[model samples]
Target chain A: MGTIVSILVLVLFLTAILTGGYNKKFLQRVQGSNMWDWLTTVDHKKIGIMYLGAGGFFFLIGGLEALLIRVQLFYPNNDFIVGDTFNQLLTMHGTTMIFFVAMPLLIGFMNVAVPLQIGARDVAFPFLNALSFWLFLGGGIMLNLGWLFGGAADAGWTSYVPIASNQFSPGPGVDYYVLGLQISGIGTLIGGINFLVTIINMRAPGMTFLRLPLFTWTTFVTSALILFAFPPLTVGLLLIMFDRIFGSHFFDAAMGGNSLIWQHLFWIFGHPEVYIVILPAFGIISEVISTFSKKRLFGYNSMVFATILIGFLGFMVWAHHMFTVGMGPVANAIFAVATMSIAVPTGIKIFNWLFTMWGGRLQFTTAMKFAVGFIPTFVMGGVTGVMLASPPADYQYHDSYFVVAHFHYVLIGGTVFGVLAGVYYWWPRMFGHKLNERLGNVHFWLFFIGFHLTFLIQHWLGLYGMPRRVFTYQAADGLTWINQVSTVGAVMMGVATLVFLYNVVYSRKSATAASAERDPWDGRTLEWAIPCPTPEYNFAQLPKVRGLDAWWMEKMAGNKELEPAEPLQPIHMPSSSYRPILMSLGFFVSGLGFIFRTIEVGVLGLVMVFLLMFTRSFEQDHGYHIEVDQIKEAEKGA
Target chain B: MKANAEQTKNQTAVQTSQESAWKHVTSFAVMIVLTAIAFAAVATNLVPSHLLVPLLLTLAAVQVVVQLYTFMHLNQKGSGFPVAFMASGIFIGVISAVALMILV
Candidate 1:
């Protein structure tokens, strides 16, 4: 199956090379840009938008894989997908969600909003930021490349050893998964460092740690989590890569190495990984809710503390996922309690949101609706989470439909919903035009209902002893009706997504040019201080931040504008270059070589990749500066 | 001009003196102790293999800490967050590896 996909991919590549229209045009345009320009493009807004567009594209692909899973599971004993095929769908769905959807979306939001919130022009490491994005794109492409070869990875997204062992599952599919994640994980680590440095060193003068916007604060902590969380994963993947490629015994049970090490390594990174995905969403919701409510976020310090506490606790509870694997009662009990304790900080965040909205004149825009909707949906998932935290109870629920329902509720309802809300909240900021409200409402309702219908009943199915990851179940199991209903919900989600796409495309063409100007929503944050379609260099001079909701503070003080921190100066901006893309391509080629070491073509490709990297490093170009005169002129026009 | 040149020469000499003194004393003392311990363990065989692994690991851990503080400058200014992040990562990695070792 994987081989067939590879053949198809080869065909597509050949076709793309032959047709040479859009793809060729894009390549030409990319080439026309100076090699150094892309390398140093220090514009935060551009990087942020690149993250959004790239992340959004991956989200669609992941979502489609999810829909395929739902379709296959819609009927009892259905053979719509075979066992290997089903495995691929499940694997791709999980991998895509973690590496593609969740990571990219969070990074996208961080890239887009972090600089604006902190009153900075760009991230601390602009070149590294660009590099991270390209590496991420390369990783994403490699992960999906399974479809073109023969099939996608058949091992679960976790790709537990013994199952993932070459003897049991002999293919390059798992290699793609490992290498894809390894490359993307590097991007994530780099991004985390960039944000950390940005927040620490580049905040506007007087915007101290305590004065930071919640979104920026969360970005800080999330970046910290990423810094701490990703190394174990890198170590684990390297070990696994060794085990597969070089015949190491890291996870070989027969060779006195333990398979459980992979689980520990994966989840050590994996558990904090959940917060790495959700905290940013939580940050987004905090901003959206407060802005729409017209209130200072209640218990702001507590909210900050809660974010920190959750991040700290995220590392402690990785073993809770291993309860059913039997690490003895003491270990299980410890992990169980630690896992449940996370709810306290998470609960504090929920109440803070509710209280912020208690008496304010609440505007129910699509973003707000999703924010409000997140409360109950996330609560349901959270409750199931507590239930699963009990070690003995988990014995029955582990690897069942209940586990699936629980996570989908949390991930989809919490993270995906938060991302959608962020998209609606920031749409005007990002693209200079609003997403059509009516269509947005339609998208939300359908998605909300569909999400509930699809996963809600699965809890009962699990209770009735339905195992997960099974391609089919007998009709006698009494899951047929619920499964059928779930299929309907899946279709509804599909319809909603289509409507969303339509809205995006339609609004782009229809919205008037002037409507693209900044602050269409009377926004409170620093991002709205700049003009719509923000400049490449965000501010001519940095704004002196006086208080929370800095822009709003300016308005209330009757200043009607921010005070500039300095005289207009020549803005030093990084130039964009193709080195990042080329560097990532090197890794992609090397990965192919590593996966198929016997092939001469693969070996040659590896050599070429190394040569490319060496050449890229040697090719140096310094960035140019945008003079003060140009900035002043642009400001005058605004 | 002669005085300034003399001062520059003195500064370089002093810097190199400090570096060499620290490097020689630390390496000789540490390497001797580590070699002695390794030989002692092999010769005596007092500790069992299971215990041996842990003991060696502990020694390695101590060595790592010392190296980080002295060589890596982890104890210096501006090293707080990076140290914290690296330590937490290593701690989590150890815990997870141990858990999986026992469980799976």
Candidate 2:
């Protein structure tokens, strides 16, 4: 079956390329059928959409893995997917959802929104932006490929040392995990740098840092967190790779190597990774709340400061995760204190959102609903987080369903809600048409209720002394009903996801130009200043940001459009290239080679990558320009 | 001597360039001397073993600043953003390193 499917896929791919090559009519007939154009395009908007598409695909795979886990746990002592299979499912579910799904989804929104918000034509490095997206996707694909080759990674997402060491669990599973994350982590690191440069240097004239939109501010902070956080993960992965593959004993206790080093290194990256995902979500909620409430974000400066503080505090609190590993009481206390202190900035942000919505016209759009729902839901997670932060209390809660409940509330209720809200909020801006609001509300209500119902009971189950990562439990344990309820909620969430997918298709079929208004939602950011289907050149002339909420300020002054920061001139756009995808493919192949321990294959792949890089170093891509006349004509059409 | 405004501007520019050149050479000389002292200290055991590491580290840190300011032009105008990012990165790096040293 696998061989047949692979052959069919190859055939379909060949057909796609061959038809386009020989038949010009077929290419012109179907819009978006120019697959080559999309393959090589360096446009940030297109790359953003591709990120969403790929992220959504992985999300479904992860969600399916989740549903299977829930099913197995639905009944006590169920023979359904026992032992290693269950472990693989759970491991892949966590790893996929966190690294592939959540990160990419948030990065998708950032790519779609940040450049526009800053009033820049494109990201500082368009080619790198494209490269980042492809590398992430490539890494994601390689991660999933583990299932096809014997088994998937089953050592849990944390991949704790000694257990994950080849001597204990000898297989290519953990090797895939190491190489895949290393590749994707590099992508994320470079993406963060790209954003930092773009945000710092690419803002329009007169648009100072203080005047940046709340979302842009969050992206900036999140990028900084990514920069500081990912290197440790990379180093950890490299060490483990060496241990597993190259006969080194980085975590081998028998060889005088300490296992505790792995935990410290992992959490050092892992803890800030929590912030890296959530900060962007916080940014989304801020944007949605303010936009739908028809108010400027209250305590904007405080919100910015709070974001930075949270990011700073995030790095200091990683050891909290290792309290159970016994780093002594003093170390635990320090980590615990640092962890709980994060609540102060988080609390400030929560209150700031509430104040922004207070005494304003609160429009309950689908986006607004998700944003409002996020507040209480995220606060619940935050409260549980504080509860778990106490080192003494954590001794009871560690590796329990209570821990699972807390993170799901934060990850699903916070990050997922924020991603959903962003999708709804920016759908029109992104695709030039709005998602059906009625279906959107249905999706939101189901997801929100299903989310709480799913995890809320698990907190009690944890309290009832149910440990996490177990395949099955005895009926005498008396956890059957709660597990069943959680499964029901998981099923509901799965159905809600289907509804969202349906909404996407339903909206696309009915999309029309009239529905694609320039200022949909009467948005306040510089993004809404451009056309709904944002122009190829995002701004014909850069929008001069005079104050906070630049668009709203202009609207209040009775202007139809932004005050242009520059005279009408040709706009230089980075030309598309095939190198990013090819480079990613080279790396992907090399990762597989390393996992399988094939020296010739690995060398071949590395040589391909180096050749590409070598050529790129000398290659000059000055990019093409859109002349003023063409810009004027496009503007007239809009 | 009555000089034109352009000539006066040129003279000032030349003078500043010469001063910059002098500063670079002086910093380079100081770096060489520092390196020599470090070598002598390590070779001759002039400093106690307990304090030698700190001395070498201090010298290394000062040399880095000199290199950045003099050679990398970090002291020039329009370098505020780069300096700020570098400082933040260093701050985070040092804190993590120190924390690891203490705890690990």
lDDT of each: 0.83, 0.90
Question: lDDT by residue for model 1 over A1-638, one digit each (tens)?
Answer: 43333344345544644664557767676557664354435456666767777778887888888788878877787889868888988899899988888888878888889898889988998878987888898889888887876457889988888788788778878888988888888888999999999999999987888888999999999999998889888998899888988899998888998888888888888998999988998998899899899887888999999999999999999988888776889989999999999999999999999999999889999999888888899999999999999988999999999999999888888898998999999989888899999999999999999999988998998998889888888899988888888778888988999999999998898889887868876778889889777888887789999888888888788876789898778998777765566566656665665665434444544565577567767877577889988987887777
lDDT of 2 at A85: 87
Colliding pairs, model 2: none
Task: List residue ranges in candidate 2 displaced over 4 A.
Answer: A1-33, B1-22
Give me the candidate number with maximum TM-score.
2
What value does the lDDT take at residue A467 in candidate 2?
Answer: 95
User: Which structure among the candidates has the greatest lDDT?
Assistant: 2
Looking at model 2 chain A, report the run of 10 residues with the lowest lDDT sum.
A1-10
Model 2's chain A TM-score stands at: 0.96
Q: Mark the regions of model 1 whose C-alpha exceeds 4 Å error after superposition.
A: A1-42, A598-620, B1-62, B100-104
Candidate 2: residue A158 Cα off by (Å): 1.1
TM-score of candidate 1 relative to the true fold = 0.90
